[model samples]
Target: MSRMILRALLCLPVLVAALAAAPSPARADALHVGLVIPQSGQFRLLGDHVREAFQVWDADNPGAFGDIVEGDDGCTPESGVDAAAAMIEAGVDIVVGFLCTESLAAALPILSNEKIPVMTLTVRADIIGEEAARLGWSFFRLAPRAGSEAEIAADAIYRFWADKPFALIEDGAISGRELVEAVRTRLEERSLKPNFVDNYRPGQATQPSLVRRLKAAGVSRVFVGGDRSDLAVIAAEAEHQGVALSFMGGDALHAPEGELPLPDGTMAVLASGVVPGPEAEAARQAFAAHDMIAEGLRIPAYAAAEIIGAAANRSDYGQTNLVDLLTGTPFSTALGPVTFDATGERQEPGFVLAILEDGKFRRLSVDDASRLTGESQ
Candidate 1:
């Protein structure tokens, strides 16, 4: 009896090994995520960076996130529609990455009908406003809407010149005019008014008259609602005409293609990229390992994937549950805490105040502001 018991105990080790080697029934039913970005054509370079970022996220996470499906929109409207349709047919739980604006426009109807959720990294102004009004839910964005950028510009100006007099200027272009008005609207809410307001014609070699008028008005600071070229011309002419005043504007001032160098201490409002926090530094190293630069859509794409994976992990791995999880809860990412309103727009969206020095954007310290205030301080 003792010999027989010993043999049985030895057989128990083999049985346990076999069971451990076998796959669990639940392991076969893993969830899936779809990455829909441009993989070819003009924007393929950006798509490559996005893909590498996703891969970096995946490598760190391993199998906890399940399968990652790829869909190439080719950075075109037609391709985006087709890519979204294919992802749906393939049975992906959620979709992320829409770098192309037109592609997002075309793919929405298809994705919406199936009730599939999408987290886009595109930064077009109308996506959450006009587009959301029509599309309703099942769509969210990682980047701030373009229209909100103007409000950020206003906020930065207000914070910097709270006790000083300033003027609002535009270049007669629709975008420039709208930006100027947006800043004016924000300022009015605070019971503050611009000391002077003016609109100048664009593409002039110089704006000596406008500069002289601004100087004569005793304006020591000016906010220009125009691109860097117009700002360059105005600043150069202002300096030449002996008018000493600081300049601030929208993100256009950050453009490296300025015809003239922007003056030192010139400030602009731009959407904040992944701020220089601990998470951002970690991502920087991860991106470097893959021989890629972390910029533009890369950080957003990685954050979008993290958002989807987190929502899925919190749910029963069903598409419906995942959608509810995304809309109802906030996901903290490298970019910051991301929460969406009912219409799929980020709540409390704001912009960063970046100062231009030697043609580079140096972010300024500012407090986060409510979306209503239109600035993150």
Candidate 2:
């Protein structure tokens, strides 16, 4: 062959070999995340918040390798199991959402069987941590448990009114009962006993009589386990009875400005995993950049996404190994830092105290309250 032809022929074979050895165009891998929440019932608002959070994160980081599949569990055990089966069949590698404990309990077995990692936003403390550890590395939580809230409330109570006799009240529901027991246990550990413990059915109109009974008990500090409306009613009744009581509970009491009907001198403490501050505001900005509104469940939902993303990123988007990622990696998100212990429980601390002022819940300074009662923060 001529010199130029020979050179061209050699280059053509080398180019062809290079083309054959090169990898195909990188196709975007879809990381399907299952969102198991109530979307058509009373818990629809919570579901909306969760979905908004996920949407916000997805928008900020477009094509970041994750998509959510809605699993409408309807806050029921049977529905939750059905939702889990559906998500598994749809090839979801990880699951998030489930505001109810009963639904989570029902869904756990199916998720475990499918080896799908679940990041629960529910506050049920007893379900996923040590319990799931015994089963496998398939469960996680972004929200602090109800028991942790109770414990934080107990600490806040000790700081606010260490010398005063207190009362523990529950609404007889699962969460309320658990909070009451948790606070009581912590009090006992400190060699203290509440002057009284009472249980009431929430939303009933008979709270006036209950307040009178609590007043008769001479309890100045009251820790009630219920929602904001229930606590507001109790606070109003206490005011009507001319009794001044300091009340505290979980983040359920946190409402927008001018929403709560608490009287003057009624101090409340709200326990939450995500403290609203600079970090939260930054997260809000990130979500807004994506044209999404930040809601109450936003932190937990994004934390779920980050948890999965961090795992995938570390593994270079390898296999659909969600359980392994959940077991091995700790995801730090906008809701402060998160690291799971051996029992699959997050070691993130919950917020301590927030008092009701001018119809709004204001975050209390631990220093001020601790000095008031000679307690350490």
Best by TM-score: 1
User: Model 2, 146-245: lDDT tens per residue?
Assistant: 5677678777666565678788898888777877798788978888788989998888643888898898999887888777778878887777788987
The residue pairs found clashing in candidate 2 are: none
lDDT tens digits by residue: candidate 1, 1-377: 69999999989999999999987544323458787877778878777767777888888777656777889977678887898889898888777777777777777778877887777776456644567657574787777777788778777767666666789999888888888998899889988899999999988888889998898889888999888888888899988988888888886665666567888767887765633334566677778887777786677777776776576555355434666677757877766678877777777464566776566766664432232134223
Model 1 — TM-score against the truth? 0.81
Q: Cα lDDT of model 1 overall?
A: 0.75
What TM-score would each prediction reach against the true structure? 0.81, 0.77
Give the distance in Å from residue 252's predicted Cα in candidate 1 to where it truly belongs: 2.2
Best by lDDT: 1
